[model samples]
Target: MDFKGLWTTIKKNAIHLFKKARKAIKRYIRKLVKHTKAGDYSVLIYTIFALVALILIIVMFANIFSLGGKKKSTLDITTTEVATPADVTEDPQIAAQMALKQQAMDIYSRNKDFIFLVDENHPLAEGYSFEHHTLNCGLDIDKRIYNDFSEMLNACNMAGYEYNIINAYIDKATQTELYNSAVAHYVDQGLLEEEAQAQVGKSVDKPGCSEHETGLAIDLTDVEVLGEEDYKSTRGTDQWLMNNCHKYGFINRYPANKVSVTGVSDEQWQFRYVGREAAEFMAANNLSLEEFMELVQ
Candidate 1:
């Protein structure tokens, strides 16, 4: 009977409820603002990111400068390599006489055929004559072969080993005479004169190159003082020469196994001075001068 009035009352109540709901939402919004103002986590997150980026930048800059410093150091060290023999020979700074004199003497002596003058006038004629004057039986190498072969001789006297210089420098004339004589001997033994001469190194420098002409090469003889039984076979002062000679720039040039490479026999008595570093390098590697030259190339 009063349904319309009841509907109007319900509508009024619903409007009041909507107002209350809106006020309640506004209060919660205010509360959220207050909590955010107290402390915002967003600032902390941004600070952390910034700090990480700063650290990365510093690390990168440090790496770049470190690499640059190393590059500069490496460049400085790459500048110096030792000069080779050919380089020294060709350099205008080095005097030609220094290079040519040794070669000239070597060539002249070879052409004259290794006739070493034992007389006073010869360059190598006079020096100290030791009490012991021979080594390795008939091997007549010079006194200069050892580092201080003379000093070694003195030591030998102290050690009771008889050291000697059976032969020293053979001049060009002497070499030629020796060659001719060897040739004659070969002919008498039934070989042709030219063939016999060819067997021995010629003073002309056409066939056999004389290592002796270098003045660095030498042969030894009569090493034993009292005609000792093991003179040739036993280890004598020459063993000291073989083991320590490289320190003084000499090598057992014609080593036993290297005969085929050197075109000469295993000359236990022969030694050649190529200088310490070169000799050590050669002997250590078992290389001949020709082989070493190739390696240098």
Candidate 2:
């Protein structure tokens, strides 16, 4: 749900809870007034009711917004959910579309350059500039990450499960093409253009802001082309790579339980090369790239 929709849901639930509590309060007040032995406890009964209502409201706000976390004042939520194959089967058209979208996310997850939050409160940076190098599959990656990236791929190949570059470098124009295509895919799913674009923006980055532009990343898969891989067959063995990818200076960029922090979905097949030191630390701690950056900064 979008921000407004979430608020509406919270408000709706809160009001429902409040009303239920109010009814209980009234029942208690009725009991108090009915009791012959009671003194002037009407004021006390009403005060208790007020405290209960206030506590419920406070708890509601805290649960939804995470009031007590040192790092989070408000929840870092996006309207989009990471679409899975199971999510689209009912609509074959959307299923087919989601299949393609999944490919894009894999690309984005692997080599798709993205913005990291500039501060504790930001999950997205307002701007970025990148210098990159040409890599396999016509992909461009940030020049600095090349040696570790190459070493990582080499090590993966040596391990018997060969990994190939699906996409590495994406220029502004090409990235825009991917983003526009994602927007259209959602529109085809029946979302209005405005909402479709907003939805797509979360799954795919806009031009100049993508991680592929940074060239420090890559999207690797067992197969070279989009449609060739047997995803089911490879599923059982993915962890070996996940566990070892860090040694070569790569980390599963969007890891499980970190969608809230990274503003992206988890992708098991995607890895981001962050030099060995940072990569090892992140993997050891199960930290998302964003979280790792936060701790270091």
Number of the top candidate by lDDT? 2
| Residue range 103-159, candidate 1, lDDT tens digits | 434433442322222211223322323222234444334444444555545654565
- For 71-91, candidate 2 gives per-residue lDDT tens digits of 432342342256655556857
Off by over 4 Å in 2: 1-131, 188-190, 224-237
Candidate 1: where are CA atoms >4 Å away? 1-53, 58-160, 199-208, 225-233
Overall lDDT per candidate, in order of appearance:
0.55, 0.64
How well does each candidate superpose onto the true structure, as a TM-score? 0.49, 0.51
TM-score of 1: 0.49
What global local distance difference test value does model 1 have? Answer: 0.55
Cα displacement (Å) at residue 211, model 1: 1.8
